[model samples]
Target: MAVEAPFWFTSLAGLGAVYLSVVFLRLLPYLVLYLRQPKDLRRCYGSWAVITGPTTGLGRSMAMELARLGFNLVLLDLHPDNLREVSDTIREAHSVQTKTVVFDLSLVGTEKGDEAMRRLREAVEGVDVGMLVNNAAVAKPGALYFHEADVERLVTMIRVNAMALTEVTAAVLPGMVKRGRGAIVNVGSGSTVAVPSFPLYTVYSSSKRYVEQLSSSLYVEYKSKGIDVQLQVPFYVHTNMLSSAVKERMLLPAFVATADDYTRAAVRWIGHGPIAVPVAGQQLQWFLAAVVPEFAHNWYRLRKHLQHRAILWNLN
Candidate 1:
């Protein structure tokens, strides 16, 4: 026996689905706040800049660049040894004041997390923190087959990527707002521009998208108050985080942007404008992905898979 649905009921359900879809689509781009705008956080040059994930990769690069620009730094990382090494390097090379706080950002928001932030604030008391870079992130390779991967890894990713960022921003924003000047730069990925075929990256990408969106909304809300929020979306660079295959795929003409190249561009654009895309050429890819028809985009992604057997292949 075939059970037929009532016409009115089916129509209403379909309409609801369509409405939800439209709302999500409208909110998607701004969802990740993945672009960083320029703002003069250096209003107090030689002042303090707080950087998370500062021991390596893009975060380390940003720290060094800021040091060169005459900003003292408070560097945070999970690895104490690496943090000490980086702190020593910056202090010696740049001859600037530096502080190293070694703690796992992923651990900071639990019952013990609140105490940690309090301690951090107390330690940096009276030091004007003018810039905050939320750049620490971790990714477990391959597709997101939930059952296959350790759930704890995903939990940590969310904690560091989303929870820690929110907590740190909340901790420092009041000071910036009170002073009527400050810059918050959140590092994100170009992958948020489109859904990747890689399974496990879904959680990581979603978390980044959350950061981007939060940054955008915060910018809108705080710009008049003199708080500058910038979200940076960059393609893959040479970082220890990626596997060799991933590195090779990222270096393709379309997808590659070196850490130094992107960081220099980002710093130059800081305090100069509202948002900055370090690699302007990469912006074209984002535009294409956003504007192209869904069918065509899917076809493009499929073609890349066929052309190269790589799990993640750049369009270039």
Candidate 2:
């Protein structure tokens, strides 16, 4: 004769089933998004794209990818020679037009910044600029207490990461609004999104948090105007921006994505969502963080920073 299961066992099994179903439902949309075809960026947004800090890292890869997809580029950077080189390379490889704008992001909000903005405005004034990628940013070479950080460096970091992003977006958005269609992609950080507190890198994380908030508000404000504003948060992309020492010891190699890998995943999500963690693996990381307690996150992050600080000390 068959026997019925115990009451507690049946209840526990039912709870397990419900939890698994919730997890699956939460993940199903992202699974579908990953499998679907990428949008026609040029056709959906515009004929031309403007990218800041286009000479390296995520900027360089994104410029190349967008050019491959047939968008003419306006490349902006502080280094004139580097800008010219990237422009020439994209032109030669993709058979697409490229305009190099040598503008220092640090100059934004200064008198010289006014002149720089004027030049940037003039560069894209008559063109069909369908998208703007604000990818340029700066961070301290290593983690340190906020009190130990250089005041000048902190100001510069804020200017480059926060002010410059704002100014560049302002320079690009009015035109996009006039045209009534465009995409604005602000490259953000996983430090801000994935953790409760980024202890030693306080200013950097705080600046990125600003990016996240601004992007969200802009997305809502401009959605009715046919503009798509998205904040693309990436975690541990292996690029020149990361020092060799930290790259080697601080984070596991398995967790780090190459710039190309990140950008390819990044491009696919453009114009689709306001906030996106482009890599699927990073999305999983975000989910795991969500379930963990805030205190646990803070404690773990603090330990990581202390380890990072020790590595920096040895190098010095």
Candidate 3:
């Protein structure tokens, strides 16, 4: 005979099952629609994709993947030579048209921003831009206290991480709406949810939190308009951005995932509703952050922070 649990134990078990059911129901649709046909995606979204910060790391990786999927691109970044190189590489490799826009998104409200936005707008006037990847952002070097950080760099971080994404969306969204279909992927950090709190990376974390909210709200406002806006929260991509911080050689399975693998997953998940933690490990990390106690998450985050700091400083 099956043994019955005590009254409180049975009640707790029932509640746990209900919680799990709720979580699964929320995840069911994304699991089913993880990927649609590439051709169908192209037809729905369009042939052109605009990627900011396309000169290096995750941004460059995403640009290449999009080109392989048969999308023309408008690539933007502060690095002119790198931008040109990326554009030429895409053109040579994919037989796809490419436009390189050397725009400094850090100057979002200045004269430079006005000129850059004007040029960017003119550059993509007749092009069918179906995707916008707001992938450019800046972070503080090392884990420093907020008071110890440079004020100028902090301001630039806000401009690049927050304002620039917003302005670029303003520049591109109307055309997508007019075309009646498009996809916008806002790149966000896993620190927003994967960790209980970010200490030294305060500004970057807050900026990503902004992107998370912006992407979700835009998804709600535009989904019925045939536009898909997804915030991709990914963790520990082994890119230049990450490589600079640690002494050890960054490797996949050791340092989360490689840039190529991460970007490929992120690009294919463009229309996966408001947020997409594309990697199974990252999804699980996010889930743990949500379900676990805040104190537990904080302890883990703090422990990892010290380990990273030690490695970065060669103190280990």
Name the top TM-score candidate: 2
lDDT of 3 by residue, 199-310 (tens): 7678888889999999989999999999999999878777766545463543346547778988877766777668888776667556656878889877876666666556
Report the C-alpha displacement of residue 72, candidate 2, in angstroms.
Answer: 0.7
Model 3 stretches with alpha carbons more than 4 Å out: 1-31, 34-39, 244-255, 310-316
Q: What ranking of all candidate models by TM-score puts the best one first? A: 2, 3, 1
The total of clashing pairs for model 3 equals: 0
Q: What is the C-alpha lDDT of each candidate?
A: 0.73, 0.90, 0.83
- Candidate 3's error at 155, in angstroms? 1.1
Please give each candidate's TM-score. Answer: 0.78, 0.95, 0.88
What global local distance difference test value does model 3 have?
0.83
Q: List the residue pairs that clash in candidate 2.
A: none
Error of 2 at 3 (Å): 4.4
Query: Considering TM-score, which of the candidate structures 1 and 2 is the better prediction for this target?
Result: 2
Whole-model lDDT, model 1: 0.73
Ranking by lDDT: 2, 3, 1
Indicate the worst ten consecutive residues by lDDT in candidate 2: 21-30
lDDT of 2 by residue, 120-233 (tens): 999999899999999999987558888888888899899999999998898899989999999999999998888888998889999999999999999999999999999999
Q: Which whole-number lDDT from 0 to 100 does residue 167 have in model 2?
A: 89
Worst 10 residues of 1 by lDDT: 307-316
State, as a TM-score between 0 and 1, how close model 2 is to the true structure.
0.95
